[model samples]
Target: MSPATQAMQREDTQNPAMLWIANGQQLWHTAPKDSNGKSCAACHSDAKESMRSKAAGFPRFSAPAGKVITLSQQINQCRSNAQQAAALPQESAELLALEAYVALQSRGLPVSPSRDPQTRQAAARGQKLFTTRIGQLNLSCAQCHDNNAGKRLAGALIPQGHANAYPIYRLEWQGVGSLQRRLRNCMSGVRAEVPPYGAPDLVDLEAYLAQRAQGMPMETPGVRP
Candidate 1:
């Protein structure tokens, strides 16, 4: 990141993403006005304690759903099955804030996704997606992240593209964003057909990212350029 970007990330006062965090904290405790009215706090009580290290293992298998689900998906599931509240849109601001807030609870912890048999297969599929060239540019994730990391592309340096520093405050984006959002951005960059928010490929790809970055510390609500 450039010097200005680095400085913005260092403190909440300089970080715009903190605005979302404040809203997320409120959502965590405010009960929805619905039939199964309940806030996340109603069940978990306190986030910092109950949610500790949970985000680090996310994008994991959901036996009930028969596939891996993201932290946002799991949160939505709770709203439906447990609280009977209307679900938030996949990439809505409210959802992002809530997701960021929850993810922040697991900050600094290592990502430790499950290594179940099904997950292994999914991870392999994700690897295929990462390596396979797509889009008009015909680029794969590996070409930039694996092959050309630490090099500049269109005036920006390409990092390893790991998912660890997610729910991040990107200077270019000017807001908090999740790993899935970043993937979509990459897809668009390649001129590839961007997948829908909860598409199977996206889910599988997220699982693979978490696995690839296994043991990397979570940098929830991280800042980036």
Candidate 2:
């Protein structure tokens, strides 16, 4: 990481994304009225300790869901099942804020998933998707993100397209966004049919990314140019 980028992540005051973190903190304690006033805090106190490294092991298989799910999806399911609350709408500000908060807790942690056997099929599909060429441009993720990483495309430098740092604050977007948003943007860049948010392919790709980024530190709410 650049010195400037490292410094940016170190402080809350300089990071505008901290607003979402604060909102997430508030929501953490917001009593769930539907489930006898229970709340996240009531179950898990102080996310800093309770959720340490939790986001690193994501895209986990849930027998109940019958497929892999991301940390964001897991959060929504938890609210519905544990608190008897309606699930948060996908890509909603509240959901993003909450996701940012949880993912932040895993900062500097390694990407590690249980890799349940049930999820192998999805992961395999994701591997194929990452390497396959598609769309009008017929560009695969590896073409730029792997094959020519660190080289210039047009006027911009291409990184290895790791998902280690996500829910990032992009200078272009002028706000924080989840990794799926970034993936969708990349899909558009390749002129591929952008996957709808929460699509199985997106989830699978996320799983592949988690494995691809294994041992890399989680840098949630990251800043990007």
- All models, RMSD in angstroms: 1.3, 1.7
What stretches of model 1 exceed 4 Å from their correct place?
Answer: none
Off by over 4 Å in 2: 1-3, 32-36
lDDT of 1: 0.87
Clash count list over all predictions: 0, 0
RMSD of 2: 1.7
Q: Which candidate is the best by lDDT?
A: 1
Judged by lDDT against the true structure, how good is candidate 2?
Answer: 0.84
lDDT by residue (111-134, candidate 2, tens digit) is 885578756667777889999998
Candidate closest to the true structure, highest TM-score: 1
**Count of clashing pairs, candidate 2:** 0
In model 2, the worst 10-residue window by lDDT is 31-40
Model 2's TM-score against the true structure: 0.93
